[model samples]
Target: MSGVQTPSIDFDAFIFDLDGTLLDTADDLGGALNRVLADANVAPVAEHIYRPAASNGANALLEAGFGDKWPELEQLALRQQLLDYYAEDIAVHSKCFTGIEQLLIALEQNNIKWGIMTNKPGFLTEPLVQAIPSLSNAQAVVSGDTLSVAKPSPDPLLHTAEILEVDPSRCLYIGDAERDIQAAKAANMYSATALWGYIPSVDAALGWQADFNWHSPIDGFNHI
Candidate 1:
């Protein structure tokens, strides 16, 4: 007699990191950073220098670019300038990664609810999500400033799941950074490492220990 094969489990919900995972906003962010630096009479940092740290938020960019000489007040002012510039040009060089649109469409068609859990500030995060035609209907959105604590703390991820009315265990979180994995694990959710997103000089395997790793958005559909 032949035995029957088991069917793979399908996730009920999906959660994503915004900056590096879903959208490639580094170019737009870098442009804003350069503008801020120039307006402050400081030399601009190279694109590569700012790309890897883009997910860390505007403060990290300001610190990395002007920490040595600028006083706290000046740094805050510059950060505001960068934020203003980014809001107007959020989509200038920013776009969804290749195959991501298809993956998202597939998920929606399969009845898999998805939302965003990003450390990006709400002001920018909300507008960017609204601007993206594909992401306009996300189930929920949790921004860094949405709560007292952000990613790597599990607060944002947990909060997202709560709002989506899904259990953390039923959600599959995808991200490109170690902090994203840390947040997912802390929330007791399944996590996938996005190999196509920015990894800088760090190895995702060693740093994140993600449940699964994929080279592209289409590759992720297989794991899901």
Candidate 2:
């Protein structure tokens, strides 16, 4: 049944995108965005509507709240307000996705190193990761602030592979965004798209061009 001894890859390391890929963090992010909208006396966005935008970061989330008003509104000020509010309640409703704990355990049992690589600033990413036991002890963490250039540049992913002491070719990277796929390809790493991550309802995962696509943590983890 093992048939032709299927070509297999022993991924030495796994790197993940923080927000939508690893954690269900929409609540805190959406919550903060709504607060900022309220301060502007605008109607708050429904949580379900903002969930997808949350994964894209503060700028996108803020734009969702601002809507047409975004053009005339000052993005920087609103983004700061959103960030400030988010900092106040970082991990309130955040938690690992279902099966992630099992995946992490499996990785550990197999002696595969796992880490985080996200565009979120280190200041915010560090505390958030620390608050979650499973996330805090990653083998390496390459945050947006860790380097001047961010993802889609491949620098962060390459940096992470170096820090983990694994060849880029031996690492598997999972993320929810298209940039994640681009970075992985550029770094010559395997790319797996986390289909369950917070992709906007208007977007399609087909365009990401990842090596493989997994709809849930179990599916993705098992694929590796």
lDDT for predicted candidate 1 compared with the true structure? 0.82
TM-score of model number 1: 0.89
Worst 10 residues of 1 by lDDT: 1-10
* Candidate 2 residue pairs that clash: none
Give lDDT per model, in order: 0.82, 0.85
Task: Tell me the spans in candidate 1 whose CA falls farther than 4 Å from its real position.
Answer: 1-9, 70-73, 202-205
Candidate 2 lDDT over residue span 2-117, tens digit each: 11212445789999999989999999999999899999999999977788797788988988888888889888888888899999899999999988888888888888999999
Runs off by more than 4 Å, candidate 2: 1-8, 201-203
- What lDDT score goes with residue 41 in model 1? 82
lDDT of 2 at 192: 80
Alpha-carbon RMSD to native, per candidate? 4.9, 3.6
How big is the positional error of residue 125 in model 2, measured in Å on the Cα after superposition?
A: 0.2
